[model samples]
Target: MQQTYQTLNALTNFYGAMTAAESARRGYIFLGSSQDLQRYYNAKADMRSQLQILQKQIHPDESQEKRLVSLNLLVNQRLSLLEQSIELYQKDKTALLIQNNITVSSVQIREKILKVIADIKAEEQTYLQDSLEQSKQSIYFRVFIEIFTTFLILIIILGLCMILENQWIKRERIRDLESSLAQEKKIGDLKIQLFSMISHEFRTPLSIILLSAQLLKESLENLVDRQQLKNIFRIQSSAKIMNHILTDILILTRAEAGQLDFKLQVINLENFCLNLVEDLQLFATTANMLRFQKIGSIFKANIDERLLYSILSNLLLNAIKYSNNETEIYLILKSEADMITFQVIDQGIGIPLAEQHKIYEPFYRCQNVENIAGTGLGLAVVKKCIELHQGEIIVESKVGTGTTFTIMIPQENT
Candidate 1:
C-alpha cells in the first residue's frame, strides 16, 4: 500500500512538472508572438500615418475627425487585450511550478505538454482570425478611399474640360456674330453711297437741261438771229454735258455689275493721249491747263483702248475741276525699266493732310472740293479700271500746296 501511494505521488509530480513546462512553453510562445503584435502595432501606426496623409489630401469640407478617433480606440483595445493574455499566462506558469515533487515519468509529462500545445494553438488561431478581419477591414477601407478620391479627381477634370469647351464655343460664336455685323455694315454703307450718287449726279445734269430749255423759250426767243443762234448753241452744249455725265454713270454701273465687256487691243499710247488733250481743250476755258509732255520713246502695249481713254479722261477732268483758274497743270509720262507711269499734277486747293489717306474710298470726296462739280465716283472708277488691268495707282497731296496722282501700269512682254 505504501508503494501504491508512492506511485500515485510520482504520477502527480510528473503531471505538475508537465503543466509547469507547458506553461513556460506557452509563455515563450506569447513572448515570441509579442514581436508579431509589435509588428502589427507598427503596421497600424503606418496605416494611421497614411490615413492622416489621406485625410489631409481630402478637402476640409468632408467629415474626418470621427473616423480618426474610432480607429485609435480600436487599436488601443487590441493592445490592451494582448497585454492581459501575456499576464494571465505568466501567473499560471508560477502556480504550476509551486505545486509538484518526487519521481515523475516522461510519458505523463508529454501528455500534459500536448494538451497545453493544443490550447496555445487554439489561442493563436483566434488571434490570427482577429488580425485577418482587421486586415480585411483596413484593405476594404483603403480601396474605398482610393476609388472615392479617383472619382472626385475625374469629376474635377471633366468640369475643367467642360468649362474650357464652353469658353471656346463662346469665342467662336462671338467671332461669327462680329463677322456677320461687319458684312451688314458694308452693305449699308454701299446703299448710302448709291443714294448720294443718284441724287447729286443725276440732279445736276437734269437741272442744266431744264434751265437751258426754259431760257431758249422765254428769254432768248425775242433776240435777233445771231443772238438767238448763240442761245441755241448754249442749250445744245448744256444737253451735251448732261449726256456725257449720263454716259459715265452708265459705264460705271455696268462695270460694277460685271456687265462691261472690254475690247482688248494694242494702241498707240502717245497718239491716244494727244487726242484726249485736244478734246479736253474745249473744257479748259476756266483757266485750267491741259499740257501733255511727250515721252522720248513711242512705247506701246496691249490694253483695252476704250478703258484707257476713260481712265485718262477722268483723271484730266478731276485735275481740271480741282485746279484754280490759271494754275498750270502738268501731264507727265515716264517710262521706267519695267513699268510705265502717267502722272497728273495740279496746283489747286490741295487735299487736306488728314483726308489724303481716305481720298481713295468710294463716294468720299475731299471736304475742300465740295463746291466743285463732281459725282465723287470718278476716282473710284479710275481705281477699279486700273486694278482690272493689274496696275497700281498712288496719290500724293499736300494741303494748300499741290496734288499729284501717279498711275503705274504694267507692260506685258510682247
Candidate 2:
C-alpha cells in the first residue's frame, strides 16, 4: 500500500512538471522571450528525469500490475506528444526568425501544439481520477480480506488474479497493434528511400547511353545508308525516351520523399509551348500532323522551367503515342489575367470515364492502351508536376473521340 501510494505521487508530480513545461513553452511563443524559452527547456528536462524515476518505482503486485501498465502507457503517450509538440514549436519558431514574419503555416503549427498539450493535460487528469478510484477500491479490498475467512479470501484473490490476467492480455494486444503500425510506417519510408536511390543511380548510365547514341548518329551521318540512318535515329530516339522516363521516375521519387526543389523563372508562354511542340516533332510518328495554337495574347509568367518542360513533354508524348499516326495532336497555350492554361488535345483513342481517376496513379496504364509500349508513368509525372506548380488539370475525354488535358496554373499576381 505504501509503495502504491508512492508510485501514484510520482505520477502526479511528473504530470505537474510536464504541465509546467507546456505552460512555459506557450509563454515563450506568445512572449517571444529568451528567458521563458530557457525556462521551458529546463522544465522539460526536469520532467524527463521525473518520468524516469516514476518508471523505475512503478512495481505493483500481480493484481494491480494491469492498472500500473495502463498508467505507464498513458504517461508514455503524454511524453511522446510533448516531444512532438516541442519539435513543431521549434520549427515554427525558426521559420519565424528566418522569414521575419508569422505566416499562416506557423500559426497552424502553434495551434496544433496547443491542441496536443491540451490532450496531454486531459489524459493526465483522467488518469489521476482513475488512480484515486483504484486506491479507494484497494483499501476496501484489503479491509474485506482481513475480515473474511481464509477460504473466502483465497477465492476472492483468485477472482481478482483472473481479472488482472484478462486486462494484461488486452493491454498486450493493444501494444502489439501499435508496434505493427510503427513497423508498417518504417517499411513505407524505407521503400520511398530505396526508390529515390535507384532512380538517382539510373540517371548516370542513362545519360551515358543517350550521349553515345547522339555521337553515333553524328559520326555515321555521312557513311551510313538510308536504312542505317533510320536505325541510328531510332537508337537515339529510344535512348532519349528512356532518359526522359528515368527523369520522370527520379522527379516522382523526390517529390514523394519531400526533396523536390523548384526554381522559378520568368518564361514567355507562347514561345515556350511552341518550341516544345516543335522539338517533340522529331520523335512524333506523324511529325507534320503536330500543331500549335495560341488562343490568347503572349505573356510572361514565373514558373519552374524544368518541371514545366517535363509536364508539357510528358503530355505531348502521351498525345502522340495514343493517337493514330495521321491524326493531329494540338498544343494550345492560353493566358488570362489571373491564370495561364495549356491544353494538349489529341485526336485518338480516349481514356475511359471509369478509369480516368486512376490514370494519374503511378505506373497505372489504361486497359485499352495496354498494347502500346509505355511505362505508364508519364501522366503520373505530369500530374505531380502540375500540383507542384499549384495548378489544376482537367481531363475531357470520350471513349472513341479523343482526350483533352487542360492545365490551368494561377499566376503569381492577377
Candidate 3:
C-alpha cells in the first residue's frame, strides 16, 4: 500500500512537470521566446528522468506493471511528437526571418501545433482519470480490509477530493484560455470587416467634393485674379489629395475583400504613361521637374487601365511629394519581350533600410515623412495594384541621396 502511494505521488509529480513543459512550449511557439523553450526542454528532461526512476522503483503486479509501462510509452510518444513540432516551428520561424515572406502556411502550422497540444491535454486527462480509478479501486479494497480505521479512511478521501478539485480548476483555466483566444480572433476579423465597410462608404462623398473642386477651378479660371486663382489651385490640390486618399482606402478595402476587378484592354504604353505624367504634373510646384523617358519601342498591350493608372499615379505623386520643387523626378518605362518595367526615381529624403520592409504595409509611413502631408496608404495601394497585375515592385534608396521604385508587369497577350 505504501509503495502504491509512492508510485501515485511520483506519477502526479511527473504529470505536473509535463503540464508545465507543455505551457512553456506554447509560450515559446506563440511568443517566440528562447527562454521559455529552454525551460520546456529542461522540464521535459526532468520528466523523463523522474518517470524512469519511478518505473524502476515501483514493481507492482503483472497487470499494474503493464499499465505503467503502457502509460510511460504513451507519454514518451507524445513528447517526441511535440519535440518534432517545435523543431518544425523553429525552422519555419528561421525561414520567415531569412525570406521575409509571410505565408498562410505558417498560420496553418500553428493551428496544427495547437491541435496537437489539445490532443496531448486530452490524453493527459484520460491517463490521469485511469490512474485515479486504479488508485480508487486499490484504496477501496484496502478500506474494506481495514474497516475499523475510520480516521485514516477520511484523510484519504479528503486528499482524493483535493486532487480532483485541482484537476477541475486546471481544466477550467484551459477552457478560459481557449475562449479568450477565440474571442480575440473574432475581434480581429470584425476589425477588418469594419475597416473595409467604412473605406467603401467614404468614396461617394470624396468623389462629390472632387467634382465640385474641379468645377470651381474651371469657373474661376477667367473671372478670378492671379492670387484667387492660386487659392483655387490650392483648394483643387487639397481636394485631389483627399480624393487620392479615398481611392487608396477603397482600393485597399477591395484588395482585402478580394473584390478588385480587372478590366483588361489594349493600351498604347508610351502615350498612356505620357498622359499619366501630364496629369500628375498639375500638382507639381515646379515646371518641367517631372520627366518621362521610354527606353525601348513601346507597343500596345492588354492592361487594366484603372489599376495601371493607380499604380503610376501613386508612385509619381509620392516622388513629387517627398522631393523639393528644384529636385527632378524621373519616370522611366522599359518594354521587354514579355514584360513592361517602370521606374520612378526621385532625389527625395530617402527611406531607411530598416523601414523599407514595412512601407508596403497599410498605413505605414516612414518616420521622416511624418511632417510631410500623406495618408501613408499610397505605396500599399500601389503594391496591391501591382499584385493584381501579377507584377513586382522593388525600391532602391539611400538617406539624403535618392529613391527609385522599379515595377515590372507581365504584358497580357490578347
Clashes of each: 0, 0, 0
Candidate 3 has an lDDT of 0.71
Q: In order, what lDDT does every prediction score?
A: 0.58, 0.69, 0.71
Tell me the tens digit of each residue's lDDT in model 1 across 1-414: 222223223333434443343344343534545544445445444544543443343222222334334434543443344344445455673443322321123334344444533443333334334444445455445534543554465467458657755765565565677776665455445434553454465555455554434433333243346545554555554554544555565556656655566776767678678778887775574533788885657446677787777777778877777777878777887765467788888887788888877865667798888667777777777876787778898888887788898898887666
TM-score of 1: 0.44
lDDT of 3 by residue, 311-341 (tens): 9999999988889878999999898768989
RMSD of each: 49.2, 28.8, 31.8
What is the total number of backbone clashes in candidate 1?
0
Best of the two (1, 3) by lDDT = 3
* Worst-scoring 10-residue span by lDDT in model 2: 98-107
TM-score, model 2 to reference: 0.53
Better of 1 and 3 by TM-score: 3
Put down candidate 2 lDDT per residue, 1-414, tens digits, no spaces.
Answer: 344445556656766676667666666766666776787778767766765665565553442344445544554555455455556666775544433222333344445434543444344444444554555455445433432433353366458657755765565566777786675455446546655554565555455555545444434444467667786577557757866876887788777656677988888777688779888987898658789988766477889989999999999899888888778888888888789998899988999999999999999998999688998899888888898989999999998799999999898672
